[model samples]
Target: MLKRAFLPPADALVAFEAAARHESFTRAAEELHLTQGAVSKQIRHLEQRLGVALFSRVRQRVLLTDAGRLYLHEVRGALDHLHDATRQVMSFAGSQDVLNLAVLPTFGTRWLAPRLADFLRQTPQAALNISIRLRPFDFELEPFDGAIHHGDPIWAGGIVEPLFPEETIVVCSRPFRDRHLLAGPADLLRVPRLQLATRPMAWRDWFEAKGLVTDTAFQGPRFEQFGMIAEAAAHHLGVAIMPVFFVEDELASGRLVKLFDGTVEERSAYHFVYPENRALRPVVSAFRRWLTAEARSARLSRESLLPG
Candidate 1:
């Protein structure tokens, strides 16, 4: 007969449960809003604590060995019980189970909007409401379960969870393309530059990167929302500086095209940010879990496209 097993830390237990259920560390990482290394580390700790190998590592994936499967049966029951007990207490304490979402306009439209259907399907019991706001770290002064913002999580006194990283690129419409002969980033000088009101430093950085200096980077219509900027570019107003990932559908649909691919600048990472006390709520936890998974899926999908 097996001896009673030691209880691992709650977080490691949660990660192990997710990984086991999905049978994929990468998937579990996404769902848990953790790095793959973090998830693996959690499982490692759990395995060491229990003195048994739970996962059989095959070439590119993990499979549940007998030990893993048996442990899962027990861990899963505990997780379900914990989840149930938490939910019962929450329900007894409150009636509104709504999830408030704060989003940047551009990303909301181009990236998250497309994937909204999936989330709604999965979490239909919860109300999903979104508020559009400017980026650069503002989680307070608004009622939201969570917000998606660009740039580094440099804000003080807030909790931030990584969703994914984004790179900005230069793009234009076909009409705006011929307005100037383009050979490189320097060619942007002759084109009308669309700007994000928040990132005034973008033009300076782009020029500095190319060893070129032109005042034209600062000489375009400034807009706050990426949706507006994209619209302006689509109408041949000017070349828009935006995230390539955000505009994937538009690019594929011929609404936009890259003027050049040379400078893929790491502008900011997408982070799910909320108030410092956000971890205390289960709705926030669910949102974090779901967002983490989405980011992971995107990363894997991108990786699969590379020439390996």
Candidate 2:
């Protein structure tokens, strides 16, 4: 026979436990909304099933026997565990499909923000939550379903889906460009060039990519965030290197002007990364499909608008 089959009925165990706590059959019946005889009969039935005397009639009150005391300890723990398990299952049922994502702060605001409405409209059933994450984080330790990684496609412990290559251009206020009398990429070395604290070698890389040599490539006022650097450049404080899409608004409004003939492609590209061994969640899959399609369409549209 199955082990569960040997267990007594839950109702009888509950009745006996109530009567044992109160030490009075009448009090137990009042709590249970039954007659005193009903509580007494349940205790008797439980005792007969277990083949042991579970209670003793003493001084017109009910007292637990040695066997009843031991059984009560185990039954109380079992019932509490069952109640907790049920509650947890119900909570999971309500929120099992919510997708949690970690993203870079600037990327989330500039690139992803404007495009998010399309994804939401396309996949209305999918619920997504985004949190700022600057660098790669441990999936085992963090409560994230996936992440937007700005660098290489190789995440140590996750699967990577390619997003796009980083295309950067030098930009500054229109007045700065005219005042400096810049003729070529080489002329930039003489002016106050801005630098990203995260990419100290950006100026040097851009210069070298144009086959120019200069010792002043590393010298500049470094800023931690791209937004701050872009703002500084827009106000004619210095010239800054920025991604094309990031400064599209500034360029369109004539606040910032792009210099040079081409963009400098960063070594690492953007990617969507997630734990390799994680079970595929419905909401996450829906988001991935929508986001990739949006990215592709945006790229094509931008390329078509560029002058040949």
Q: Residue 288 in candidate 1 has what lDDT?
A: 81
TM-score of 2: 0.67
Best by TM-score: 2
lDDT per residue, candidate 1, 1-308, as tens digits? 13344457899888888888888899999998999999999899889888899999987788988999898898889889888557645643433567777788777877788888887677766666676777544556655657887788765656788887776678888767876666677777777788888888887787888799776668888987788888888888978777767666667778887776443647578888877777778777777888889988886675333211
What TM-score would every model get versus the actual structure?
A: 0.62, 0.67
Which lDDT values do the candidates have, in the order given? 0.77, 0.82
Give me the candidate number with maximum lDDT.
2
Worst-scoring 10-residue span by lDDT in model 1: 299-308
Candidate 1: C-alpha RMSD to true structure equals: 20.1
Number of clashes recorded per candidate: 3, 0
